[model samples]
Target: MQTIVYQIKDAVYANLTNRCPCACTFCLRAKGPGVYGSPPLWLEREPAQAEIDAALDAQDWTRYRELVFCGYGEPTERLDALLAAAARRKALDPALRVRVNTNGLSDLVNGRPTAALFVGKVDCISISLNTDDPDEYLALCRPKFGPAAFPALLRFAREAAQAVPEVVLTVVGEPVTDLAKQTRCRALAESLGATLRVRPFENGTRRFPVP
Candidate 1:
């Protein structure tokens, strides 16, 4: 069976979908069956709320410090399901920190202000800011929304910063590490009231032991 919930380090991750609007060149899906030590994430169909609740309920919640909505595809692509599952998790333990790792194209995908949906349910929102330049972002992410995706992403990040407790914009270490570019990314993130995180490129070829 495909993995619905899996461990990565100390956090538990939920795989909600394989439907994504962007075709990122560095997407982990292209690297292997799953990231770290999880099983293949390609689901036969996106899990409904009941299945997600069961998968999460099966786990010893206290064993993980955080629960993240992330997998082979964009979690917000399954917005209703994501919200339902997150609400269930938060209801179980109000103190549990819940997060979503996304491409930040959710509003564009939904054609609405999706950040508002996360307000009280999520603790953190991590957005992929692949590059500071719009053109570079388009080239790297190749979003189906086209050039408009860049601006929409920025708007989403700004809005998310207000709706969620913590908002972070991230750049992959390998492709966007020039001193000037990093500086620009940090400044832009700061302008949006968000922090910039430089994520190291993990070798997705093997199943890493969970800590």
Candidate 2:
């Protein structure tokens, strides 16, 4: 069966699509068929809105602290559905927190200023800022947008900071992202009114930073 929604620690994750604009070298999908022992995340087809809702409704919300839009692909690739689901979840439980783990490429994918649409729907937006340099980003992520991806990502993060309550730019810790580079990434994130999170690296497993 398709794993539309699954639990990871204290959060419930929504897998909306299997399409993404970038093909990062370190993407977890390359490492395995799943993450942290969840079902295979490779979706045969994108879930319909109703299916997404059904999966979400089946969850015991009280057991999770947050609802996260994350999986094998970029959640913003299904921007409308993602926002709708988040809005509905908030309506169901006003106290529940919602977040989106993104590559900060939504504006490029959607072809417009998309951050403002997140207001009132999600509490946090986590963007992967793998490196502080644009050239390095091009080489590492190989985003379809090429060189334009890095600046656009920063722009999205800046705008998102104004719209979303919590905006975080993330980088892998240590070996992949050295201390000096992390410092630069932190400065860059702060310059855009966002904070930086260093995701811990494990030998054989991929881990995402908690919101």
Candidate topping lDDT: 2
- Residues 1-211 of candidate 1 have per-residue lDDT tens digits of 7689988778899998999999876676776777666788889888888999899999887788899999889989999999998998899899999999998999988889898899889999999887899998888879999999999999999999999999999876654366688899999999999999877654544212111
What does candidate 1 score on TM?
A: 0.93
Best by TM-score: 2
RMSD of each: 2.8, 1.6
Backbone clash count for every predicted candidate, in the order shown: 0, 0
Show the lowest summed lDDT stretch of 10 residues, model 1: 202-211
Score each candidate by Cα lDDT: 0.86, 0.91
Per-residue lDDT for 1-211 in model 2, tens only?
6889889899999999989999887788887777877888889899999999999999998799899999889999999999999999999998999999999999999999999999999999999998999999999889999999999999999999999899999998887789999999999999999999988876545543322
